[model samples]
Target: MSALPRHVSPARLPEVRWLRSSYSTGANNCVETARPSAGPWAGLVAVRDSKDPAGPALLFSPASWTRFADRIDRL
Candidate 1:
């Protein structure tokens, strides 16, 4: 359980396949998510602004993502 990096350059995670929620409108103004398929980032979730594809990504564990979503759902 080492501390995960808070930010990563999107270029450094080329293998990560970013996806946006289906709920996102055609304006493409939503956030995107990626699950690194290889390397040390494998199995962790990556999030970045869709408007800035090359921007830094925020990493989150599966459990942490679920909790955050749950909290949002309750709001």
Candidate 2:
């Protein structure tokens, strides 16, 4: 199996409003997303598992996040 990428812990990351995707209908497997207040990643998006809020957050650049959204939309 391929190794997964490492991410920073959500507890260490700045606090922000974590919004659930509209597509998630109170599901346990939903993803939660938030934006950091300050850092090299300010304005960047961070995503994590809703079931594991304190777990690692996957950071993404604005452009990268847009591309990811587009890909998901296409799917």
Per-residue lDDT of 1-75 in model 1, one digit per residue for the tens? 999999999888986778999999989799999999888888988999998998899999999988987998799
Give the number of the best model, judged by lDDT.
Answer: 1
Can you tell me which runs of candidate 2 are displaced by over 4 Å? 1-6
Residue 25 displacement in candidate 2 (angstroms): 1.3
- lDDT, candidate 1, residue 31? 91
The per-model lDDT (C-alpha) reads 0.90, 0.79
Which residue pairs in candidate 1 have backbone atoms (N, alpha carbon, C) closer than 3 angstroms, thus clashing? none
Best by TM-score: 1
Q: How far is candidate 2 from the true structure (C-alpha RMSD, Å)?
A: 4.9
